[model samples]
Target: MSQPLTGVKVLDFSTLLPGPLCSLLLAEAGAEVVKIERPRRGDEMRSYEPRLGEDSANFVLLNRGKRSIAIDLKAPDALERLMPLIREADVLIEQFRPAVMDRLGLGYAALSAANPRLVYCSITGFGQHGPRAQEAAHDLNYVAASGTLSLTAGSDGAPVLPPALIADIAGGTYPGLVNILLALRQRDQTGRGAHLDVAMADNLFTFQYWGLGNGALGQWPGTGTDLVTGGTPRYQIYRTADGAFLAAAPLEDKFWQRFTELVGLDAAALDAMPPPQATEAVRAAIARQTAAHWEQRFAGQDVCTCRVVGLEEARRDPHFGARGLFSRTVATATGERMAALPVPIDAAFRATDATLPSPALGADNPLLDH
Candidate 1:
């Protein structure tokens, strides 16, 4: 099957996570992505720890199936060098702060003037015109500013650090991909492109919609007090006797009853107890057994409870293997290979032979000469 973005051309000027991830998704969907990097020193992510040949494992993982073109955008004739490619490009995604691209003469207005159908996307920590637009931030800061971090408090009421880069991938990357696709569709109708201002901080509010809705009606519970956050015994992580954890989320009454019964707890007693007391009782019951014991106990159960496996175990799990989630491998410049990072795009949209090694600096510059 042909990929949805089979013939689209993208010029990616993003670094690190958000914009690179967005372009990576597009590349997986069969877009021909040309990543524009600075001369000599490329994306900083290339220097991250756990090296794979010339670049870091992270760089190789995110940049597979894409071309690299090195150019110093700060140079006087950089815009002239990029004009030819921009004119032929379908999308241009950048992650610099507001006005940085404009100062370099490659902002949306300038690029769109040359290519009227170009989809120019800017992924930033905040929107271009926001009060915090120019403020430096990373994934954690963006989530903190968005009020989403406050909801991730631990039992002691301190905000827990997120296990993943939620703001970067969910807020910036996913939203940018969605809007860019939407802009492409819109361009097909109007014969004009658009400037997408993807604000990581702004997009995070969607994740808190339930909390926001509840808070609006003066039903605001304190941190870690919501049904999904730890207020109830039905949904939480419990430590086992072996110090490993099991995530229990039997939210529905029937599933909760099943879980309670399996743990040898009286369902009626838990029901009559207050939430804190019920939570304590559930915790005590789970602590009595090792994680392996609970894992075996819940193996074929309908209850929504499971042991928390580490990343290495998850990577080797039969379920993921059966689904072919890690079937793809990415090669480094030196021909070393590692498992390709997973993207959520359907397998149908990915070419079976799509894997390509991360490019050396200026490896594809000849394409720009034309």
Candidate 2:
């Protein structure tokens, strides 16, 4: 079966999480994504240790379903080789610091002149024109700048970095891809490309809708009291007796009522308690039972809750497995089987049962004439 993005070519000059992830999505959707990396060393992420082999799991995961072209961007011959490829590309994505592309002569003004219909996207920690645009930063810095760090961790506990780079993935990668696709659609009608500047920090504020709303309305409470950030009893995690954990988010009254009933809460106990006290009581009750006990008790209930799962447990989850959430495919470089990326379009499009892999370094540069 033919894919929707077949024949579309993407030149990926992004590295690390955000840029590569965006292009990976394009590749999964059937676009031919050529990842342009620095010569010799390649992507810095590939050297991340703690994995079992030469290939870093992070690099393998993000770079799947795309081709790699290792080149020295500073070299004169490199730009000449890339210019021809740029002329035929539908999209060009980069995550360098502001004006780095312009310095290399591959900036939007330079490249779009060669291909008017090309969608040029630049992802950065801060926006292109911001006061901090030239500052060197990473995911932690971006989240901190966006004010997202204040809403993280518990009140008494030290502010902690999230397990995921929410700013990079949600703000930078996903938004970049979405805008690039929108630009492509607009170009289809107008025959003109667009230059998109996606800032990782800007989207952080947008992701914190509840917090932002409160700040705007002058009703946003202090750090630990916010509704969605573990403030209320209805949406929090509780530790169990066996050292495991269970997550409950019964936001609606019906679900909360069901939760209280399942836990056998008395009317007097419920009436006399504040939200925090109620949460503490619930936590104490949960701590009395083992995780397995709660899992059995909640089996048939319609409560909006479940156990807190780690990466390994999530991989084996029946619900996700049934839906083909972590489908496997073979890598073209080493023929190694690995989990395919999870990106659902609609019911008509099956995200699983399709085999595609990341390209070996510079594998597709020879196919330039095609």
Cα distance off (Å), candidate 1, residue 131: 1.0
Question: Model 1 has how many clashing residue pairs?
Answer: 0
Error (Å) of candidate 2 at residue 52 is: 7.1
**Candidate 2's residue-wise lDDT over 278-334, tens digit each?**
788888888998989999998889888899989988889898999867665636476
Score each candidate by Cα lDDT.
0.91, 0.81
**Residue pairs whose backbone atoms clash in candidate 2:** 68-362
Global CA lDDT computed for model 2: 0.81
Model 1 residue 219 CA deviation (Å) reads 1.6
Model 1 has an lDDT value of 0.91
lDDT of 2 at 112: 86
